[model samples]
Target chain A: MTKQVVILGGGTGGTLGANRLRRELPDDVHLTVVDQDDSHVYQPGLLFVPFGLAHPEDIVRSRRRQLHSGIDYRQESIDHVDLETQTVHLADGSTLAYDLLIVATGAVLTPEETPGLDGPGWMEKVFTFYSPEGAAALEGALASFREGRLVVNVVDMPIKCPVAPLEFCFLADWYFRERKVRADIDLVYVTPLDGAFTKPVASQRLAGLLQEKDIELVTEFNTGEVDGEAGRLVGYDEREVPFDLGVVIPLHSGADYVGRSPGLGDDLNFVPVDEHTLQSKAAPNVFAIGDATNVPASKAGSVTHFEGEVLVENVKRFLAGEDLDASYDGHANCFIETGFHKALLIDFNYETEPLPGHFPASVGMPLLKESRMNHLGKLMFQWFYWHALLPGRDIPGIGADMPSAGKQTETAH
Target chain B: MPTRTIAGATVDVNDEGFFTEPEQWNEDIATELAAESGIDELTPDHWKVLEFMRSEYFEKGTGPTVRVLGKTSGVTVKELYQLFPKGPAKMAAKIAGIPKPRGCI
Candidate 1:
């Protein structure tokens, strides 16, 4: 008997999961991947688009082209999933019944959720580099600006690429300096978090870098309204930060379809999964990964890549009626791009915060310290993302668990 | 972890004074924590939000974000700001004997 496996969203997690499952599962199991569109984007390149460092066309490819030969690809909008029925309903009134389901539709930006954010001055003075259109539009907006306070505000947390806004600030500092107008601009990074990042050691280090670059750090500002017409971000507490140009990372939530699905998602529509197993709490046969899950891990591509290894194995185990593997230790690593051709790498998981030292081992990439080598690694990741990561090929030496062998436990002086 | 005496009870607390051991939390301890944050008394409305936070944290292993709390906690966003001044999510979590909601790194 043939078993049906339906995977939602053709983005990073979905594509990787489908490809990996194709390789691991028996040929008797049929796989179908569904998404609204055919274009697969390299999301990391969105950050560089506003700086004119990368073009949109270079970062996008047809979704069908990336999938394996045997997998089925469908371009259709999702309506809802009936958990009890084990079915997915499409917007076109079609339905897919599956023996197993994987929800990978990642987080989406909701600028309209905040009052006045999508209103007047949007794409002119207020811009976001999170999307292809937003990033391309911001390039034009950033080019003409000469002076005044430019504010980069994160409306809230659990956003994809949590460090991108800070990366934008660093890149902007370098961009303006290259244009010799850096001294004329006051850069401010306003966030909902108490500091530059979630982890303590990394936050202190990144905060110091922001200070050295002369960017103002405003903590605990939960933006309630974006009065783009008046050029001010009003927080819920009524605290305000005025801006000449605003780069806002608006609120993020899981796919709207998830919310429409009954008994599947949380308040924000993110699938509640076992933190280690990636098995959906809603049902034993349903699983989730990446930004789609409320896993308390950074919603980054690297996390999705690490999760793919565990998720595929678990899916296989569940089908065999065997005990599922719970070895996923929330391992996530990211290269934080600072300006001036230097970047810092941080590697940590659920239990350990990012510490300073080498990554993978003592001889690997330096961790939590700025270096030109780390910057090069950031640039080279685009290639690895497309050629290696999306295909579910393992990056040798890096695995599902975070390595503690090379990291320094003692605080650095 | 550090120990602090709040409302005559010695409790384990983190650096930010949030209860490290949530089991040590009591209504009296919550009153003292709220008082430190400038809420003179725990009104019925305040307890609604506090109880919601504790239940969500113990069950989910995380405190709810302001957006989540506002949407599902039977508390309106506007009322949440009014009830727990400044940063409602962090402030309410502290008083509710839960660790502050964390941002993903």
Candidate 2:
């Protein structure tokens, strides 16, 4: 009997998971990857689009091309999953019954959830760089603007690539400086978090960078309304931050199909999975990874990449009727792109916050310190992401667990 | 971690005064914590939000964000701001004896 394995959402997690499973699982196991569209976007590249650093066509490829030869790639909208029957129903009136289900449907931006956000000034003055179209549109908006306050507002938490907004601010400062209009523009970063970021040590360091770049940091701002026509972001607490142009990361939630499937997701439609195992709490046979899960990890590609190793291993264990591996330590590493050809790299997990030192080893990339080498690493990652990461090939030294070799534990305090 | 005496009971708290151990929390502690945030009194409406936060924190190991609470906690976002004042998620979680609602990143 062939074991049918259905991987939902052919984005970063699904593509990697399907490819890895094909290599690991025997010929007896059949793999099917489902997604609404055929485009597999290099999401991290979207950040550079508005700055005119990268083009749209360069970052996108066919989803089917990324999968292994034997794997099935289905381009159809997901209607819902019948968890009881272990089946996925497609919008095209078809069903996929699976022995194991992997929910890799990542988060989606919900701009309409906030009042007046998708209204009047949308794409004209208020723009988002999360989507390729939005990023392309913002490029025009950003290129034209030479003065006035440019507000980069994160509507709420759990957004994909949480550091991207801050990176945008840094890049904007550099871009405007290149144009010699940086001194004329007021840069403000509005976020719902109490600081510049979630983790303390990193937040302090990032807050310092923002200060050095003259970007105003507005903390604890839960956006209630975006009066785009009026050029104002009204907070739930009635605090208003006026802006001439707004770069907003709208509220994010999991895939819609997860919500339609009963008991599979949370209030935000993110699948509730065991933090360690990536096994869905709703059912033993169902698993999730990346931004789709309600796990307290950054909704970043790095986290998804780390999770793929553990997730594939667990799926194999589950199929063999063996104990699952709970070795996923929430390891996440990110390269923070600061302006002026310098970036900071930070590595941490569930138990420990990001600390300053070298990453992977003492001779590795410097952690939490700005360097030109880290910036180059960021630029080179687009190639690494498409060629290596999406194909499920391991990067040799990096693994599922965070390494503590060169991290300064004392400096974290 | 640090210890603070609130409402005549010694409880463990973090630097921001959020209860490190949620088991040490009680109604009296909640009352005193609420007062600290300038909510002179805890109304039935306030307790409604606080109770929801407590139950959610215990079940999920983290308090709900304001958006989640507003959508599912039987309280409107407008009412949440009215009840908890400046910051609904952080302020309510603090008074409700839970860790601060933090960004996942």
Candidate 3:
């Protein structure tokens, strides 16, 4: 009997998961990947687009090309999943049966969820760098600007790449400085969190960087409205941050298809999974990863990379009817780009916060400290992403475990 | 902050022995630092990477990406790891006496 594996969303998680499983399982176990479109984006590059550091054409590659030769790639919009029947229905009225399903549709940015955000001034005066179109538009908008209040706001939490809003402000400071108009600009960062970042240790360091860069930090701001025409962002509590140009990261939720599949997702449409095993709580045959699952980890590329390793191993074990490995510790790492030609790297997992340490060992890049080397590593990652990470190749020495060998545990407090 | 005796003078470094002040770098200090980082001595090949990284940092105010470093340094990425195990950018810069190079967490 031949078993079929159907994966949703040929983005980072789906593509890598398909390639990895293809290599693991026998040729008889057919693997198929479905996506809304063929374009697979190197999402981290979106941050550099608005800063003129990258081009949209350079970051996007065909998702079909990303998968391996043996894997079947379907270019179709997913209509819904019939959990009981173990099948997926496409918008074209076509259906496919599967013995196992992998959901990796990730999150969708809902700009319209915020009143007046998508109504007027969208892709005009107000923008988001999360998408290529938004980033390219912002590049032009930022070019003509000499001086004014430029505010970067987050509508809510659990947005993909949580550190990106902070990165945007840092890059903006550099952008204006290069134009030699930094001193004339009033920069502000508005977030729902009470500090600069989610984690306490990193937030203190990031808050200091925001302060040093002369960017005002607005915290606990539950945005109620984006009065783009009036150039003001109103929080639910009635506090407002005025802006001439606003780059907003809108409210993010899981894919719309999740809504069509009952018992598969929560109110926000994220599949509830065992944060460690990635097994959907609602169904044992279904698994979720990346932004598709409501995992208490930062929704970033690195999290996908770490989870991919564990998910692959556990998927193999699940098929063999063996006890699963409950060992995924939520390991995630990210490069925080600070202005002035420097960046910072932080590696932590579910249990530990971002600690100051030399990652991998005492030989790697410094932790929780800004440096030009970290900036180079950030640029180099785009290359690593396409050539290494997406290929499901194991990164040497780096693993899912949060190492304490070279870490200075003092800062973790 | 931890202090180490390099070039017969006490210098400040983080817990991992990365120099806090790049300006205090000297040849004698680099040799000692290299030895501590597991290199017996700065080979002519090692100097090839270190020198290029130095000029790039001094010119651009930051080190070039490792991909650029591999393309320009005559030393390949594989050789870079052999020379500086684990991480080439920060390890080489720390030993080369330049400001800490940053990227990918």
* Best model per DockQ: 2
lDDT of 2 by residue, A1-413 (tens): 89999999999999999999999999999999999999989999999999999999999999999998999989999999999999999999999999999999899999999999999999998999999999999999999999999999999888999899999999999999999999899999998887999998999999999999999999988899999999999998899999999999999999898889999999999999998999999999999989999888899999999999999999999999999999888889999999899999989999999999998999999999999999999998888888889899998788879999988998833
How well is each residue in B9-94 modelled by candidate 3, as lDDT tens digits? 78878766767776667888889889988899799988888888888878746665454565578887657767877457777988
Give lDDT for model 3: 0.86
* Candidate 2 accuracy as lDDT: 0.92
True interface contacts reproduced, per candidate: 0.72, 0.84, 0.00
Name model 2 segments beyond 4 Å from true: B102-104
Provide the global lDDT of candidate 1 against the true structure.
0.92
CA deviation > 4 Å runs, candidate 1: B102-105
- lDDT measured at residue B19 in model 2 versus the true structure, 0 to 100: 84
| Per-residue lDDT of A367 in model 2 | 94
For model 3, residues A1-413, the per-residue Cα lDDT tens digits are: 78898999998899889888998998888999999899999999999998889999999999999888999988999999999999899999999899889999999999987789997888888999999999999999999889899999988767899999999999999999999998889999998776898777888988998998899999867676898888999865567899999999998889999989988987578898998899998899899989898888899999998889888888888887887778888888999998677999999888788888787789998889998899998989988888778889887777877787878878644
Clashes of each: 0, 0, 13
Candidate 3: which docking quality band? Answer: incorrect
Instruction: Write one digit per residue (lDDT tens) for candidate 1, span A185-212.
Output: 9999999888999888989999999999
| Candidate order by decreasing DockQ | 2, 1, 3
The candidate that achieves the highest lDDT relative to the unseen native structure: 2
Candidate 3 residue A216 Cα shift, in angstroms, is: 0.5
Q: Higher lDDT: candidate 2 or 3?
A: 2
On DockQ, the stronger of 1 and 2 is 2
